[model samples]
Structures are given as C-alpha cells and as structure tokens.
Target chain A: MAYNLWYWPGIQGRGEFVRLSMEAGGIEYRDCAREEGAHALIENMATFDRPPYAPPYLELDGHAIAQVANILLFLGDRDHLAPSNMNDRYWLHQVELTIADMVAEVHNVHHPVGSGAYYEDQKEEAARAAKQFREERMPKFLRHFEAAAKSNEGDWLIDHRWCYTDCSLFQLVEGLRYMFPKRMKTLEPDLPKLIGIHDAVAELPGIKAYLDSNRRLAFNEDGIFRHYPELDAA
Target chain B: MAYNLWYWPGIQGRGEFVRLSMEAGGIEYRDCAREEGAHALIENMATFDRPPYAPPYLELDGHAIAQVANILLFLGDRDHLAPSNMNDRYWLHQVELTIADMVAEVHNVHHPVGSGAYYEDQKEEAARAAKQFREERMPKFLRHFEAAAKSNEGDWLIDHRWCYTDCSLFQLVEGLRYMFPKRMKTLEPDLPKLIGIHDAVAELPGIKAYLDSNRRLAFNEDGIFRHYPELDAA
Candidate 1:
C-alpha cells in the first residue's frame, strides 16, 4: 500500500526526516503536498475529524499518523528501518527524539523570540540563540550522537544495520552544514563518526537516487535550517 | 520488579509527566532522583555506558529508557495505561507526542532566546514569546485537544479508559494554570472537555494520593511552567 505523506510543498522541513527514511527504505509513498498544492494539503488535513496539530502526517489504511518521530516509529517498525528487537527499537527511538529536539532548537535559532514573529524582528535574539546553538548545543549534541555511535562497534548508530536514525542524522548534518557552514567546518574533523554516517547514508541507492532527483528539495531561507551568515562562526 | 525513575530533584518538570502516568496506572517505580540527592542522580547517570540525553529516564531490568514520551509509551504498554488495539495505541501516542510539542513550546516561552541564557537576560524576548503563547498557542492547543476529545464519544483523549495522554494533559493544564492563571481562567470556560479530563484524571485514586503526597512537586520558576505575572493576561 502506498502511503500518503502530507507536508508543506516548498521546503524540506521536519517532513524531510520521514521522507529520507521512506526513500532509504524503498517504501511506497507519495509526497501529497508536493504532488498536489499547499491548499490541497491544508484541505486534506481539515478532512480528518481529529486532525493532526500540523503537517508531516502519514496516512495509511485510512489512519493518520502525526509527529515526526512518531511517524518514523511506525514506518521504522513497518519497513524494518528500525531494529528487529523491541529494546533496540526504543534505543533507536531515543536518538530520533533527540534529533527532533535538535531540530526544534535549529528552528529556534532563526525565530528565537517566537514562531509568530518575523525573523527580521527577532534577528538580535536569533543571533544570541544561534550562538548558543552553534557554539554550545551543536557540539554537545554531535558529541552525544558520536558517543552513541561509538558505543556500538559498527558504523551505524545502532547495531550493524542502518536504521531511520541514520537517515535523520544525515539530514541533520546536511541541514547544519548548510545553515552553519563555518561552525560545521571547524567541528567536522572532531565528528568523524557522525560525518561518516552522513556520508554512508548519502551513498545508499534509494537515497542517492532521490537526492540526485528533483524530488529532494534544496535548502533555502524559507526552511527550518535557514542560512544566515551572521548566525554562524568559525 | 520495581522500576527506577531518574530526574531532577526539584520542581515537577518533565519528570512529572512520567510520575503522573505511573501514579494513574498504579505502577511500581521509585523516584530515584528524589530519594537520592541531585549529585547521586548525576553520578548514577554517569554510570550508564549509553547514557540518555537527559533525565526522566526509567531503569527497568538493567535497561534504561529516556525521553518522556518514550518512557510513557513503554510504561503505557506495560501497565495497560494505553489502548490494547494497535491503532488506538498509535492515536494515543500521537496525542501524547502533540502534548510533548506543547511542553517544549511552554518551556520556550520562558527561554525564548536560548536555554543557556538566563531568563532575566532575555526577559524582553520572553515577554513577546509569552504573549503569543498565552493568547494564540494556549487557545489553539486547547481547542485542538477539545476537538480530539469530542471526536471520540469518550471523555478521555483516546479510548473511554484513562490513558497516559490524560495524565500528561492533566499536567499540561495544571502547569499552564500555574503559569498563566488569568489566561487559563479566561480560556477554561471555553474548554470544558479538556478541563473535564483534567478534573477526572485528578480524581483517579493513585493520582489523587500522589498529588496529596510530597511525590508530586510544586510548580516553581525552576520548572518548565514558571509563573511570571508579566507573561499572563486576563
């Protein structure tokens, strides 16, 4: 059965994590918002009697699943993108949740004061927030992920097999590099394992094809990981 | 076997979500951080080879599970705090995840600029953030929850029985009321179903006793829902 994935059309926001996982797993799914228009997405979301809080919901067998990590959790279990064992699945989930946390932080770096406020209005606060995110949080999260990677004697984040966490991490690294080129440049050498996983995921047949295609949206200022030169430093 | 829960000592922070679930479910778990000192909590965390991103972790049968929603998902399934059917479980999980989203947003209202910076340092930004939260987000989330409640012909967020989502929603209402009394007072009249579930959850035998006991810590500035009069409106 093909999955109906609904997200905003233009930019790869949190939805990209789910998309990357599907693409990597070779799962059958349609980017509903992209194929249709943004208006169709909103109208479809409204049709759900108990609609999700936001976009990036997956509709399968007439059931709508929301939340990036929650969606990944379902897809991971279904597509075997998560570990076979339940215990390991939870561990992989922990990493996904952490990635979600970092994603939220990444968005805050641009709109620090509030999501309702314009980025220009909160530029000063964004700079302060971005500094903490880049200088302190980025390194800390990368180190935490690195530690998780090293704990297992494999290149993957967990076990020897690739999981959805790896795909999400690949996106996280790509987004971070685009948003904070200088900071990532300085930190890349120290985060060899994370960098390795990012590179490895990029090489996956499905992901490689998808990334090379127009299906993969380019990073832009409109997206979560927006590039603002002022927000990054070496 | 009893489970061990590790979280910060003071304030009903994120840990409260876990505590409320265990309480409502009548599950056996020790508040590790509360019984042991804060230093002990840190020392214990250091012992984990694959340490969690942060506390509010559950140590069960030598395996540690972190992330509030992840912990709740495990405990919900274990203690039957969640629905038995797989679809309802996912639906419950979706609501729980949405509640988690609001919790993150709630925390952001206080630390709008950055978690590293003091609230006092970013009071102006927080004031702007809190206004949007109190006026727009508070109503939006509550209305969305109310719709969820109305969708099912049940009082609980999911099935007729009390699920872990109810407990988290209870905490959300309690925290929001503490953080924004005037705002909640104005909005509560329009949110009967949410308030009804909040009241019903409190009436649960285990939860009632726990709230009365010292196990349920009081809300304070140190916690996610800090009551700053400036952040609220009538």
Candidate 2:
C-alpha cells in the first residue's frame, strides 16, 4: 500500500530525509503536501488524535508516524532498507539520531537567535554560529560518522548494503556543501568515506530517478540548509 | 545484569532523562561518570569500535547504546517501561523523540549562538532566544504533549500506563519550571494533563527515593536548564 507523507510544500527541510529513504527503498508514498497543498497538510495534522508536533509525518496503514528518524526506522524495517540483525539495526538508528543532531545544529547556524527571527535579522549571531559550526562542530560530527563507517567492513554506515542512514548521510553532505561550500571543500578530502557514500547513493537506481525528477526539491533559503556567502569560510 | 550509563558528572543534563527512566523502571545501572569521574567517561568513549557521537550511552551486555530516545527505546522493550504493543510503543517513542527535540531547543535558549561560547559571551542573543522560547516554543511543545496525554484514556502518554515518554515529559516540565519559573508559573495552568503526568511520575516509588538521594543531581547553571533572572518574564 502507498503511504501518505505530509510536510511543508516547498522546501525539502526535514521531509527530504524521509523522502530519500522511501525513494531508495523503492517504497510507494504520496507527497501529500506537494500533491495537495500546505493547508491540506496542516488540516490533516490537526485531525490526528495524537498529532505530530511538526511536519514530515508519515501516515502508515492509518496512523501517522512522525519525526524523520522515527519514520525512517519504521520504513527501514518495513521496506528492508536496514540490516536484519537487531544489533546492526540499533546501530543504524544511533547513527541516524546523531545525523539528526547535526542537522539541528546546521539549522541553528543560520538561525542562531532562533527560528522566530529571520536570518537577515540574526546575521551577526549567525556569523558567529556558522564559524563554530564550520571550525568545530562540522569536523567533530563528520569524524564520528567516518569512524562509524570504517568500523564496519564496508562502504555503508552499518554493513555492506546501503541503509537508510547512508541515505541521510548523503543528504547531510549535500546540505552542508550547499550551506558551507568552502568549508566542505576544505574538509571533503578528509571525509573520503562519507563522500564516497554520497556518490554511491546518488548512483542508486531509485535515488537517481528521484533526483532527476521534479520530486527532489532544490535547496533554497527557505530550507534547513540555507546558503549565505557571509556564513562560509575557506 | 546491571548496565553502565556514561554521562557528564556534574549536572542533570540529557543524562537525567535516562536516569529518570531507569529509576522509575527500578532498573539497576551505574552512573559511570558520577562514580568514576568525567575523565573515565571520556576515556571509555574512545575505546568503542562504533563510538557514540556523545555520551548518555549505556553499556549493556558488552555493547554500547547511544542517544537518549534510542536507549530508552531499547530499555522500554527490555525493561518493560513502554507499551508492549507495536503501535503504542512507536507512539511512545514518537513522543519521547519530540520531547528530545524540545530538550535540545531548551539548551539552545541559553547557548543560542552555539555551545562553543559561554552564555555570558552571548547574553544579548540569549535574551532574544529566551523570549522566543518562553513565548512561542515552550508552549507549542507543552501543548502538544498535553494533547498527547489527554488523547489517551488515562493520565499517561500511552494507554493508562506510565511509559518512558511520561518519564521524559516529567523531566521536561521539571526543567522548564527550573529554567523559566515565571514563564512556567504563567503557563502551567493550561497544561493540567502534562502537569498531572509530572506529578504522578514524581510520586512513583523509585523516582521518589532517587530524588531524595544525593544521586539526583540538582539543577544548576552547568546543566541543560539554567535559571537566569533576565531570561524569565512573568
């Protein structure tokens, strides 16, 4: 059965993470907000007895499962995008949760004073946040992911096969490159494993088709990874 | 078998969320950093083949499980702290993860320009961040949780049971009250169900004993929830 995925219409934001997994797993899903409208998504959310706090919730069977990582976890098990063993499954989840932490930090870099204020309003604070993210946080998170990838005897995060975490890592690298081009360029050589995963994921049949189609939203100022020239450093 | 929980020693930060669950569940686990010292926690983290990105990791049966929600999920299943049914269990996890999101945001209020800098160094931005958090973010999160608590037939987040999410919600309310006393005082009346859950969790036999013990670290500036007079408004 096709699932209903509800999110904000325009920007990929967090929703793209779920979309990437579904596409890579070859799972059938409807982009509810894109197909209908953001208003419809909002209305649909309000109707749930246990409503999601934010967007990127998936309606599976009849229930709405929210949170990017949580949605991916369910899909991983259902669609076979993750390892079968319990230990590796939990490991994959741990990696995804860590990726989620970095994604939150990445968003904070552009909205240092918080999301209530616009980036233009918080430019000065964003500059400071961006510097720390580039200099300290970025390397710290990437190195941990690299070590995780190396720990296993394969190119993927958990095992020989590309799991949902690999899809997320690809999105993370892509977003970082879009948000901090100079910083990523300087750091990419050190992150060969992570970069390799991104390249490999791009070549996956389903993901390639998804990326080539209009379904993959372009990175823009409205999304989580907003690019500002002032926030980038070489 | 007892588990070893590694977290920073000084404060009831993210680790406290894990502690609350273990305490309420009556599970035996050593708080590694508090007993052995923070240096030990650091040294131990380095030895993991698939290292956790940050601490609050639990060593169970020779392997480490990281991330608060992921660990809690594992424990929820293993220790009987969550619903046994798959749908309710996933819902419990969704709530816990959303609580995790708010916890991250709550920390960010004090360190809005990023954690590399001190709150003193970013007080100006902190003021802005705190205002938005106290006004918009906190209520938005608490209301969603309140709705979740009310959605079910009983007082807990799930079907009449005190699941791990309830443990987390208790901690969330406690931290908010400590961090933003005036704001929480103003907001608490509207959150009757959530406040009820918090109160109920506090009275649980294990939690009561744990809180009265010295092991329950006091909320301080060093932790995730810090009281700043300037940050709270009536």
Candidate 3:
C-alpha cells in the first residue's frame, strides 16, 4: 500500500524533509497535496480521525503521522533510516530535532513577526533576525552537529551508515546555501564532517534517483528556506 | 539511577515540558543544571562530547538527550508516557509537536526577534508581535488543538487514556494563563476538550506530587513563558 504525503505543492518547506526520507528509504508514497491541490490537503486533514496541527503529515497504512521529525522516526524504524541499537536511535532523534530547530530558525529569520505576515512586510525585523541567524545561530548549530558527527569514527552521524540525520543535514546545508550563500561559504570550512554527511546522502542511490527526477522540489521563496540575498553576509 | 536534567533554573521554560513528562510518568530525575550553578551548565555544555544546541537536555544512564520534544519522546517510550501501539505513538508525537509550536509562539510574543536580544531592545517590535500572536495565532492554534482533541476520544488526543500530549496541553494552559490571562479566559470556553486534557494532566498522581513539592519551578521573567502584562491582552 502507498502512503499518502500531504503538503503544499508550490514549495518544498518542511515537507521536503519527509519526501527526502521516503525517497531515500524507497517507500511507496503519494505526494497527495502536491498531486491534488491545497484544498485536497485541507479536506484530508479535516477528515483525519485525529487531526494534525499543521501540514506535512504522512498517512501510512491508515494512520496520519504529522511533524517532520515524527514522520522521520516512523520511517527511520521501518526503512532502516534509524540505527539498530536503542541508544543510537535516541541520538539520531537528538540530531534530527537539532535540524528541526535550525529549520524553525530559518523560517523565523524570514518571518520574525507572524506566519500570517509576509516577509516583505516584515523585512526590517527579518533583517535583524537574519543577522543573528546567519552569524551566531548558524555557526552555533553547525558546531553542535559537527561535534556530534565527530564523536563517531566514520563519516555519517552514526558512523558508516546513512541515517535520517544525514538526509536532514543535506537539506540543512542545501537550504542554507540557497538562503545564505555568503554565510555558508565561511561556515562550511568549520564543519567538514557535516559536509561529508551531505556528500554521502547525495550519493545514496534512491536519493540520487529522486533528486535527478521531477519529484524533488526546488527551494523557492514560497518555502521555509527562501533566498533573500540582502539577508546574507560573511 | 536517577536521570540528570540540565536546564537553566528559575523558570518552567522549555525545561518544564521535560520535567512535566517525567513527573507525570512517575520517573525519578534530578534537575541537574538547576541544582548546579549557572556557570556549571555553561562549563558542562562546553565539555560535552556531543554538545547540545540548547538547554532542557536529559542525561539518562550515560546518554544525553537534548531538545524538549526529544527529551519527552525519550521518557515517553521508556516510562510508558506514550501509547503502546505504533499508530497511537505516532499521533502522540503529532500532538506533542503542536504543543511545541504553541510554546514557540509564546516565546516569540515577548522576544519577537528571537531570544538573542533583550525585550527592552525590541520592545516596540515585540508589542506588534505580541498583538498578532494574541489576536491571531493563539486562536488558530487553540482551535486546531480543540478539533484534534475532539476528533480523538474524550480527554487525550488518541483516547481516554492519558498520553504525553496531555502533559503538554497542561503546560500550554499554564503558560497561556500566565502570559495572557484575559485572552485565555475568553478562549477557554471555546476549547472544552483542550481544557479537559489540561485539567486531567494537572490532577495526575505524580504531577500532583511533583508540583506540590519545590521540585516544580514557577514561571518567571527568566523563562520562555513570562508574564509581562503589556504582552497580554487586557
């Protein structure tokens, strides 16, 4: 049976994380909201037995799994996106949540006021927010992730294997590059292991196939990670 | 062995969510960072092999779990804080992320530009941010949660049995009441099931014992959920 993935069609946003994990794990799934329409997502969400608080929810078998990290956790166990050991699984989640925190900060840099408001309207605050995000927050988060990757001997987060954290690190790097090109150039050198994780994930057979295909959505201004050249700096 | 929870002392903040989950589950854990001096927290994080991005990390056995949602997820699985079934566990996480979203907005109401700056530095912007949050975002989030609770069985998100989501709901209500008493009073009538979940969790056996003791921290200016009268609606 195919799982149903519901998210906005126009942009990747948080939904791309779920899509990446699914594609990497070779899971059969439908990008329902993208295939149908935004209204289909709305209707499906309403019809859900236990409604999700936001979009980017996945329906497997019959259950709808919301939250990007939670969806990855489900897929992690099912498709070997997680490490086999219990402590390994726990640490994988810690790294995943760290990725989610960065994602949230990325969104905040664009919309510091409210999601209801446009970035253009909140540009002044966004600039101030972006300064902290691009300078302090970005480096600090990258350092933590760098240390996490360094703790293990091998390239990936859990060493030798590509887990969900690897896929998320790839997205984080990709999104940061698109969002803050100038800042990423400097930060990249500070985190070689993270770059290795990114390279390894990009080389994953299924992920490579998905990225080469039309299924993968590009980073647009409509998504969480938007490129505002003015918001970037060294 | 007792778990060591490391978070800044003096406020419920992000750490409280983890505290509530452990308390509700009847798990014995120490408020490590709170007991240790603030300088110790800074030093401990500096020495951590796999560094945490922020506070509210739980050190269990020898593993350190960071991120509020992640810490709760760890305890949920270990102490039976979540439902046994896979689907129920997924839904529990879905609801928990929504609570995380709510908590985030609460933090943003005061620190509109993110926590890197002081409230005085961004007071004007924070006022506008708080207005949008109190007037728009809170209602939308509350309605989504109310619908979610209603769609599930009686009290909890999935069924009559209490889940980790219930503890989060309790924190949401407690935070809202502290931050926006007037606004929450008006919103409460419309959110019966949401309120019921809060009430149920508040009266849980372990939580009652925990809160009654000095183990539970009160909401203060130092924490995420602060009570600034101006930020609240009169």
Cα deviation at B26, candidate 2, in Å, is 0.9
How many steric clashes between backbone atoms does each model show?
0, 0, 0
Best by lDDT: 2
Q: On residues B1-234, what C-alpha lDDT tens digit does candidate 1 reach at each position? A: 678999999978999999999988888888888888799888887776676888889986666799999999988887888877878877888888889889999999999877977899989989988888877888888899888777777778876788899999899999999999999999998888888899999999999999899777889999999999998998
In model 2, what are the clashing residue pairs, if there are any?
A: none
How accurate locally, in lDDT, is each candidate?
A: 0.88, 0.90, 0.84
Better of 1 and 2 by TM-score: 2
lDDT of 3 by residue, A156-208 (tens): 88867788878999998899999999999988998998898899999999999
Each prediction's TM-score against the native?
Answer: 0.98, 0.99, 0.96
Q: What RMSD, rounded to one decimal, does every model reach? A: 1.1, 0.9, 1.6
List ranges where model 2 is wrong by over 4 Å.
none
Q: Rank the candidates by DockQ, best first.
A: 2, 1, 3
Query: Judged by TM-score, which candidate is best?
Result: 2
Position B190, candidate 3: lDDT = 94
Candidate 1 has a DockQ of: 0.75
